[model samples]
Structure formats: C-alpha cells, structure tokens
Target: MRIHHDWKGLSPEARGATVAMGNFDGVHLGHRSVIDAARAAADAPLGVITFEPHPREFFQPDAPAFRLMNAESRANRLGRLGVDHLYELPFDAVLAGLAPEDFAREVLVDGLGIRHVTVGADFCFGRKRSGNAQTLTQLGRELGFGVTVAPLIGDGRNEYSSTAIREALADGRTRDAERMLGHWHRLDGEVVHGDKRGRDLGYPTANMAVGGLHLPRFGIYAVLIDVLTGPERGGYTGVANLGVRPMFGENRPNFETHVFDFKADLYGEHVSVALVEFLRPEMKFDSIDALIAQMDQDSAKARAILEAR
Candidate 1:
C-alpha cells in the first residue's frame, strides 16, 4: 500500500481515494467494518487515515500507555485488510489544534481528495474532539464526497474495542482478547542474551528485553513464535513466561520462550510471539527442581492447547 505523510505525497493520479479515518489502534473488527465500508465504495482506492503515537499518548503522558497494536503493526494489519494507502499523520500540537472545518478542508478534501469517507458512529475529530459523525457527513455533502458512520458491532453481548481487549489481556484472558481482536495478541522483539539461568536448569529459552509493548498479565502462556531468521526460521508452538523469575530472585519482568522441538540459536535475532492462551499465573518455586516440574506441566498444557487449535 502507498503510505504518505502529506497530501502532496499523493501524485496527480492519487486523487479520489476513499478514506477510513480514526486512531485504528488495534485495527480490530470494529475498525475493519469502517474500512470495509470505504472499500465497498468503489471509484476510489481504500485508504486509512490514522495518527502516530496516538493523540492520547501525546496529550496525556501519565495516562496508562495501553495500546493494542503499535504503529508499524497497525499499518501491516491494514495493508493485509486490503488498504491501498495508509496515511500515518504525525500528531502534534499544530494538527491537534485544527478546527472541525479546517480539518475537513485541509485533511479530507485538500490532502486526500477523498471521494468517500467512513468512520465509527462515535468518531469525533477536530480541536477538543468537537466534531462528530454528523459534522463529517454534512461537510462531505458540501465537499462532493460521500460519508458513512458505521454502526457499532459486538460479539453479541458487549461491543468489542481496543480498550476492552487491553483489559482482557491485563486480566490474563487471552481468549477474550482474541475474540475482540479476531486473532491472538502478539508482540515482536529481538531475542537478546540473558543470564542463562534457564539453560542451567536444562530448559533453554530465548530471552527478549521487554520495552514499551503492552504486556499481558504476569503469567505463563501457551504461545506460538515465528523466528524471522535463517533456514531454521519458522513457526514454533511453545510455552512462555512473562514475569519476574521470582524463583530465581529476579525482581524485573522478563520474556522467555522455549520453542518446542526446535534447536536453533536465536540470539540477537528478531521474533514475533503470539500469546494463544493463559497457562498459569507466575508462582515462586521453592527450589529449581520444583520450577522444572511446573515448567514440564506448562509445556504439556501448551502443546495440548496449540495442537487442539
């Protein structure tokens, strides 16, 4: 998909694209509905207009930094969803201060030459979130563009949302989060070297230094990892520990995955891990033998879950 920072980045041939505008944090089912609507509106290419760093992160640093998907991952998912263009606008004080009409004029009309636009029914934009879907529809009529406010869709009981997904993860409910996300929650990071304690215990693991990625609740999980590397590169269903190794006296969170039946060195290599199901909560083992026994149980559980799925 073509990506642009500004409308000028669009060539003479790039006018008249249909746009789905929003934060698109997770690109979950709800977000997909709006994008699908834009795609259905023919005579224009499908485009997604999203913000970087999420305006919430910019305006309120102290706010919980929970995010369903990072910017790059969001773009990747949107592209897979058939988006022809993904406009990741830099969110800053200047852009944040735009009036409703100016935003429509400068972004939707002038920048994108949008032939049609789609957004959630509750979508709001412009300075202080003053603009609503009604405002967008009204402006579209004046600007010769079509506008659609997609209805909220839920999995029967409750509406699916990124926030809800995060909450589910925080509660160690991978299955619930997957229901909303339409897929397993995942993270990508490099496999850095670690204290070799797992090796000492006869259970080697690939360690990744956790960063800003929103981690799931502290627990052991059944996970599938794709090693993006050499001839040994492939998918592996494994068990992962995402917490401080309390049994070993570590007081900081760590991510260690033991790939099943695979003996490839992943040091310094990047891999993406998808959390499939929660196996158990983090527990302090009285001895190394006890930890190994619990790990054996976790591995068996993970294999069963992965195989069943």
Candidate 2:
C-alpha cells in the first residue's frame, strides 16, 4: 500500500476515496469493523487516515510507552487488510491546534477530497477532541461526503480495543491479546549486534533494541520469529527474552531471540517476533550455569508449545 506522509498535493488517484480514520494502534478487530464500514460505504478505493506519534504521545512526551504497534507495523497490517493508501498525518503543534470545523474542511474535504469516511462510534477528533461521530456526520453533510459510525465490536464479554489488548499484554496474557487482535501480538525491529554472551552459552541470539516500543513484560516468552528482510527470510519457532538483562547489569531493554536449532547470521536483518505465551518473569540468577539451565527448560517448554500448534 502507498503511504502518504502529508495531505498536500495528493495525486488524483489518491483523492475522492473512502477512508477509515483513527489512531488504529493495533488495528484490532474493532478497527477492522471501522475499515469494513468504509469499504461498504461505496465502490471507492480503500484508504486510511491515521496520526503519527499518536496524539497521546504528542501531548504527553514523558508518558510511558503504550503503543500496541509502531507505525511500520501498523502500516504492514493495514496493507495486508487491502488498504490502498495510508495518510499518516503528522501530529505536531500546528495540527494539534486545528479547530473541529477546520480539521474536517481542510483534512477531509480539501486535503483528501474524500468521498466517504468511517470512524468508530466513540471516535473523536480536532482540538481538545471536541468532535464526535455525530459531529463528523454533520460536517460530512456540509462537506459533500458520506460518514459511517461503526458500532463497537465485542465478543459478548469484552470489547475489542487497543486498551484491552494493552492491559492483556501488561499482564503477560498473550493469548487474550491475540483473541482481541485476531493475530498474535508482534514486535518488529532490526537485528543488531549484542554482547555475544548467548554464543558463549551455546544459545546464539539475534538481538533487537526495543526503543520506544511498548514492552509487554520483562520476561521470557514463546515466540514465532519471521525474518522479513534477509537471506533467512522465513518463519521460525523460537524463544525470546524481552528485558534489560538484570543478570548482566544492563539497563537498556532489548529483545533477544534464540531461534531453535537454527544457525544463521541475522545481523542488520529486519524481523518480526510474535509473542505466543509468557514463560516466566526475568530474575537475577546467582551463576551463569543456573541461567543456562533455566534457559534449557524454557527452550523445551517453548518447543512443545509451538510444536503442539
């Protein structure tokens, strides 16, 4: 899918399209319902209007990381869902100060020339979030566009939402998050060189920094790793440790994945790791041998869990 960073000078092919608008953090089931609403609006190309850095992050720069998926990951998932264009609007001071009517007039009508737009029932926009779905519909009437407010999708017990998914991940409940997301919760990054301690311990790992990415839990997890851009471009069942390495006296968090029985140089390669299940919380071990022994056990359990599926 084509990603348009700003709405300025949009191509003719990108104009007059139907768009699903929101933050779309995880692009979970509820977000999909909104997208489906846009698709049902008319026989127009499918597009998405989402914010970059998220409005929350823009307002609260010092807040803890809470993104379910980064921009690249979100775009990849939306592309898989058949989005033809992604309007990733920058969330800066100027854009954040836009009035409700001006946002609709400048962004939807003048910028994108959208023929139809869809948003969740609870969606709000513009400065101070003063506009709701009703406001959007009323604006659409004046702006010469159709508006759809999709109802929240739920599983009878819980609503499918990014907040619910974040709560599940914070509690180390990957399965629950997956149920709401309709896919495993994944972290994507480029493999970088590490201390090489895993090599000496007989468990070579591909390390990736988790900079600004919302960490699930500082623990070991059963994961499925996909090599997205490398010679080893394929999926592999693996075990990963997502933490600051308390045993090694490291403060910066990173994801270290040890691909089971696989040997390949993955430095500088991009990969996506899906958390399947949480194994155990990270703890400081007295000796290196103790850590290796626990790692051996974690590997066996992860292999069994992965193979069973």
Candidate 3:
C-alpha cells in the first residue's frame, strides 16, 4: 500500500479516492469491514486515514496506554487487506481542535480528494468529537460525496472492537481476543541478550523487550514465533513468559520464549510472536530446578496444542 505521512506526499490522482477515517488501533475485524466497504465503493483508490499517537493518549494522558498496531505492523496488515493508500497524520493540539466541517473540508475533500467516506457507526471526531456518523452523512450530501457507516460487527453479546480486544488480552483471554481480532494477538520485537537462565536450564530462550507499544497481560502463553530470517524462517511452536522475571531477581517486564526442539543463536534479530492460547499465570519458583521442570510440562502442552491446530 502507498503510505504517506504528509499531505503533500499524496499524488494528484489520489485526491478522488474512497476514504475511511479513524484511529484503527489494532486494525481488527470491525476496522477491516469499514476499509473493505470503502474499497468496494471507490472507483478511485482506497485511502485509510489514521492518526499517530492516538488522540485519546493526548486528550487523556492518564488513560491506559493504547494497544496499537505499530506503523510497520499496520502497514503490513493494510497491504494484506489490499488498501491502496494509508494517510497517517500527526494528532496534535491544532489538528485536534479542527471543527467537524473544517476537517471534512480540509482533510477529506481538499487534501485527500475523497469521493466517498466510510467510518464505524460509533465514530466521532473534530473539536470535542461532535462529528457523529449522522453528521458525516449530512456533510457528505452537502459536499457531493457519499458516506457509509458500518454497523457494529459483533458475535451476539460481544462487540468486535479494539477496546474489547485489549481487555481480553489484558485479562489473558487470548482466544476471546482472537475472536474479536479475526486473528491471534501478536507481539513484534527484536531478540535481546538475556541472563542465560533459560540456556542453563537447557530450554534456551530468545528474549524480547517490550517497547512503548501495548503488550498482553503478564503470563505464560502458547505462541507461534516466526524468526525474521535464517533456516528457521517460518513459524515455530513455543511457550513465552511475559512478565517481570521474578524467578531470576529481575524487576522489569520481559518477553522470553522457549522454542520447542529448536536451537539457534538469534540475538538482535526481529521476530513476530503470535499468542495462540493463555497457559497460566507467571509464578516464582522456589528453585530454578522447579521452574525448569514446570517449563518441560509447558513445552509438552504447547507442542500438543500447536500440533492439534
């Protein structure tokens, strides 16, 4: 997909596309439905309009940090979904204060050259979020563009939403989160050098450090880690511990994965780990030997689950 951070970067031909606008935090199932609908309606390109540093973070600094699909990950997902253009704008004080009509005129019409607009049913924006779906449809009629508002995509009582997915992950409900996301919850990071605790136990794990991005709740998970390169370039069954290594006297959170029946030197390499199932809560063992013994059991269970899938 063509991704442009600045308005000036968009081509003249790009102005008349169908546009879908939102934060699109995790780019979950609901977000996909809106983007796909816009793509189907547009004779021109399909443009995805998103904001960096989600406005909620700026507006409510005390709010829980967002569970976001980072720029690279979002781009990859959008490409997979056949998006033609991605417009990621900086969310600042000035942009945040734009009146609903002003945003529709300046960004949608003037900048993006949008012929049709799509948004989630609950979407709101511009100057105190006064721009509801009804407002947008009204504006679209006046502006000579079409507006499409998608109904809430859900399974009976559970609405498919990024917030709901975040809650699921935070509570270690991987399967529930996956149902809402239309895919497994994943973490992307580089393998970092660790204290060799896993190696000493004969489990040899690749450790990843969490960043500003959101992470699943602290626990053990059955995961599939795809090493970015090398002979083992594809997915491998593994068990990951996401938490402070209380067993080893570490005071900071870490992601440590033990690849079943695999051996490799992977420090400094990047990988994407998909959490398939939550195994158990992280616990401190009285001895390293006990931790190692428990890991053997976890590894066996993880292998069985991955095989069954």
- Candidate with top TM-score is 2
lDDT of the structure predicted as candidate 3: 0.82
- For model 3 the TM-score comes to 0.89
Better of 2 and 3 by lDDT: 2
- Cα lDDT tens digits, model 3, 21-137, are 888877899888898888887688888888876787778877756755666667666776888888888888978999999888887877777899899999999899988999999
Winner by lDDT? 2
TM-scores of the candidates are 0.89, 0.96, 0.89
- lDDT of each residue in 229-284, candidate 2, tens digit only: 87889999999999989999989888899999899899998888999999999999
Clashing pairs in 2: none
lDDT of 1 by residue, 176-250 (tens): 888888877876677889998888877799998765557789989999998876666778889999999778788
- Candidate 1, 149: how far from true, in Å? 0.9
- Poorest 10 consecutive residues by lDDT, candidate 3: 64-73
Distance from true position, residue 10, model 2, in Å? Answer: 1.9
Can you tell me which runs of candidate 3 are displaced by over 4 Å? 13-15, 228-232
